[model samples]
Target: MSPRQTLTSLIVGLVLPSMAAVAAGKCERLVVTGSPDAPPYLWRDPQDPKHLMGANADLLKEAATQMGVKVELLFAGKRSQALEEVRSGRMDLLADTPLNTGELESLDFIHPPIAQNEIMVWTRVGHAQPFNSLAELSGHAGAMSEKTRVTPTFENTIKEHLTLAKQPNLTQAFQQLMLGQAEFVLAGRYAGLALTQTLGMSKDLQAQPLPVDTPGLYLALSFNSACNDPWLRGQLAKKMTELAASGRSSEAVARNLELWKAQLQQPASTPNQ
Candidate 1:
């Protein structure tokens, strides 16, 4: 072959593969899912039942906006279903993933978690007890929603040092506390407070000022996601860091907490008599 022809072929070979790599790495959009019942973090939009709306959803949107990407936060059944969707790569992101060692195999967690989940202790008003640390609840019988997840180490500590019951939902867990079936209910501060107001239990129950555990709330991408590339991850991490430093993360949380309250106050629709 001629030297000129061989050089031309080599140039084409390198350029084509480079172009393909760029195309493969492009991430224009992402599909996200998370706990549908986690309020102020995420919850199903009552008006638009198919999508999720709350602090985490809003914050993620803001981050994606900065990266010039469109994000859809959808409600995919329960929290377990949402996790599975991300794990299977059917969904690109999990908005409020807790740090889990086991999940490391299937997911890539972004650094500087988006938020800290304050798992507080809630007890009936008149029954309030001193709660400075998790160790204080050693003998007391506690309850928490089955869907709530703490760190694996914390879970092991609970098993070895605490007596806790897992209930179907936060309301049931709080009910157990109020009925004297359980001493205290462990739950996310905002999530528990939201339920208290909606259930009209705020007057009867109160959350302790101290949290039992504060776990990092992260944004994770599935290993199988088509858009799971270093460029996308770096952009998202940079956006998250900026949001945290700008105090916008706290503002989003406050806004969503109020938004959830207003949504609950809206009168339910009725059929014509």
Candidate 2:
């Protein structure tokens, strides 16, 4: 080789290994999970039982795509189990986590929450009474899904003045309200709407206009994850900020609501396939 070609080849040989190492160290893929029953936010994909499909899943996937990272949103059983998986470092990310003191210790929450959820009261249609605030329901009996978590203040209020029952799921909570067993059911507005529509109970239930609590839903990374590096966290936070500003996160909810409706209309797939 000529002297000039030899010099260029030597330079290339020295730089390529360093570049490859850096690329290899970067996080290329993340394993993510979340609540398997929250429709329009997250739920198991009927067609693909191993994965989840919905608004939060879509938003997370889009954000990761923009960051040139592949994300696998999986069905990790119940919401509690999903959180545990992330907490144990078995999963890299929790897609739609709500801020709570208990979770902060085991997970690093990405800033600029991806979505805000309104916790609302649902009462049977025609049975609704004035509910301008949570205080108005103080003396009333309420039902909530067993997995639902409320603010500390709300929990105190329940302990002090409210009579609340925890049901196995939101459907049971709503059923209690419908049967007049409970005066109201506390649930996320979109989730309640999705359930009502799917169960053909839309005409029977109404959500109070006033939200009891508005909680921001965040993306959480397990501290033990190999990919839990500053670059990965910062990139995710930046993408989430952009998504929040573009209003696409809200749009994702609306879009997935329709998607959920369409999916439910299809005939049920046979089990044990």
**Top model by TM-score, which number?**
1
Candidate 2 has a TM-score of 0.87
Residues 1-273 of candidate 1 have per-residue lDDT tens digits of 899999999999999999998877889999999988777878888889899998889999988987889999989988789999999999999999889988999999998888777889898887746776887888999998986778778888888999999888787898888789998888988878877887788998898888878888899999999999989999989998998899988898889988877777668821100
Count the clashes in each prediction: 0, 0
User: What's the TM-score of each model vs. the native?
Assistant: 0.88, 0.87
Stretches of candidate 2 exceeding 4 Å from the true structure? 1-21, 267-273
Model 2: residue 178 alpha-carbon error in angstroms: 1.6
Per lDDT, the best of the predicted structures is 1
Model 1 / residue 96 / CA error / Å: 1.0
Q: How many steric overlaps does candidate 1 have? A: 0
Find the 10 residues in a row with the least total lDDT in model 2. Answer: 264-273
lDDT of 2 by residue, 31-108 (tens): 999988777788889889899988989999998898899999999998889999999999999988888878888999
| 46: Cα error in model 2, Å | 0.9
